[model samples]
Target: MNHQTTTIDLIRHGEPEGGPKFRGSQDDPLSVLGWQQMRSAIQDEDQWDVIVTSPLLRCIEFATEVAKQRNVPLHVEDRLREVNFGAWEGKTTAEVIAAEGNKLSRFWEDPVANTPPGGETIIDFNQRVVEGWQHWRDQLAGQRALVVCHGGVIRMILADVMGIPLQKSFGAVSVPFACRSRIRVDQSDFGTLTSLHSHG
Candidate 1:
């Protein structure tokens, strides 16, 4: 088979209206700054064949706007949503430490072995995100695509593409709000991650 290349732009959704907290599974919409951030991040990109986004409001809202403005097809993927933080949802780190203590710390340090109470396990979350990545990678082969997703999801995808171990994936790279990453998918279905950019 001839080699085909697919270019995918992974964009983390802008800041949510809610202040810093475990936003996993939280449906907060984008704040004013969030809208500005997404708008700015995409300003440089001229076009895309398709736009995909997490089902969460934080990602989908801006993705919908972009899809409409750019006249691109939009797809909502639940697997791309942020890992559900369970009881930690909407709680700050201090509060979580006061509540779960070592378990939360363990989760922070070694996500694969440690899991937050009532939250999705890192292994499961990685599998889910991988499925989404594979689906899109195959579908968008030989085309340029954009995905609006969460920081965790973006990190997971990047780790998979770069062969980074799951334990080191969480902080291996920083995926700031409205950050954009580029990935190239070759004909063999392997992904190579390149470029880290943020909106001004």
Candidate 2:
């Protein structure tokens, strides 16, 4: 059996405009520095068959431009959005601490069991992202593509690709703003990491 290889680059969106906060599902544009970081990470010679990105402004804003410039197809993937923080949207850790007290800490320590009120559970989020990844892997088989998405979404996908336990998925990988992780998918639908946790 001949195994086909497909390369996918997962890029975390640049810093958001709003100051530090849970910003999940809280659509915000990228900061000026965010744009610069993205531009710096990619180059004109970079080749991609398609550009897949989250619908959020931070991810789409730059993705739109890149796709246009490269004349490649751009796909807005909803599942690529960040983990929904529910009621905690747009609230800083300090603020959440002041109001919810230790709940915030508990969530951080064990997010799978301690999901935020009305927020997405780690299991649900992981399932959704994994489905999305598998769908794309099949659709873009043997093609090189760029996936621009959120920190949480990227981490979840990385965990899925790396076979990390769902319970320890979050924070298992630290994806800084504009960071890039490369994944190679084989004929068996398994992914191998070529490069990871790079701030490019």
Candidate 3:
């Protein structure tokens, strides 16, 4: 039996205009440095056959540029957007800590259990991301693809692909700005994390 393989590279958007904060669903554009960081991350790599990105401006803007430069197909996937933080949207860590006390820490410890008030639950977020990932994986099978998305989105997909417990995903994976992770899936739908890179 011949086994088909699919390659995917997941890249998190860099710093946004508001700097570091709970940027979920905020739709902020990338900062100047964010653009530089993203460019630097992919400067040496342009082997993708297609580029998929979140609907958010931060991911789409850069994805668009790269797709055009590489002359590849570009897709904007809504499910690839970051988790919605609801009441915590657009707030800094210090602000959230001051307002909600240890809730932030607890949420970090186990996002599946301690959801931010009014935020999207980890279960729901994971489901959507997995669905989106499956769609892309199947749609672009046997091709190398790049997914430009948010940190939370990448973490959830990575957890699903690698069998990392959803509760432990936050602590197990660290997806900083412009970080890139590669996944290769075989004909049996088994995925392996091939490599992970963090760009400065």
Q: Residue 155 of candidate 1: its Cα lDDT?
A: 86
Residue 148 C-alpha lDDT in model 1: 94
Q: Candidate 3 versus the native: TM-score?
A: 0.92
lDDT of 1 by residue, 136-164 (tens): 88788789899999999988998888788
User: Of the candidates numbered 1 and 2, which has the greater TM-score value?
Assistant: 2
**lDDT accuracy of residue 27 in candidate 1:** 95
**Candidate 2 CA-lDDT value:** 0.84
**Leading candidate by lDDT:** 3
Candidate 2: segments with Cα more than 4 A from true spot: 188-200
lDDT of 3 by residue, 1-200 (tens): 45677788899998999899998999899999999999989855569999999999999999999999889999999999899998999999999999999999999899999999999999999999999998998899889999999989988887877788999988888888999888887674454333333322
Q: Please give the CA lDDT of all the candidate structures.
A: 0.84, 0.84, 0.88
Deviation in Å, model 1, residue 97 alpha carbon = 2.3
Where does candidate 2 have its weakest 10-residue lDDT segment?
191-200
State in Å the error of residue 76, model 1.
Answer: 1.0
lDDT, residue 131, model 3: 98
User: Could you give the C-alpha RMSD of every candidate to the true structure, in order shown?
Assistant: 3.0, 2.6, 2.6
List, residue by residue over 1-200, the lDDT tens digit for candidate 2: 45677889989888888766898899999999999989988876778999999999999999999999989999998988899999899998898999899998787667898899899898888888888987897789889899999888887887777777776777567778888888876664454433343434
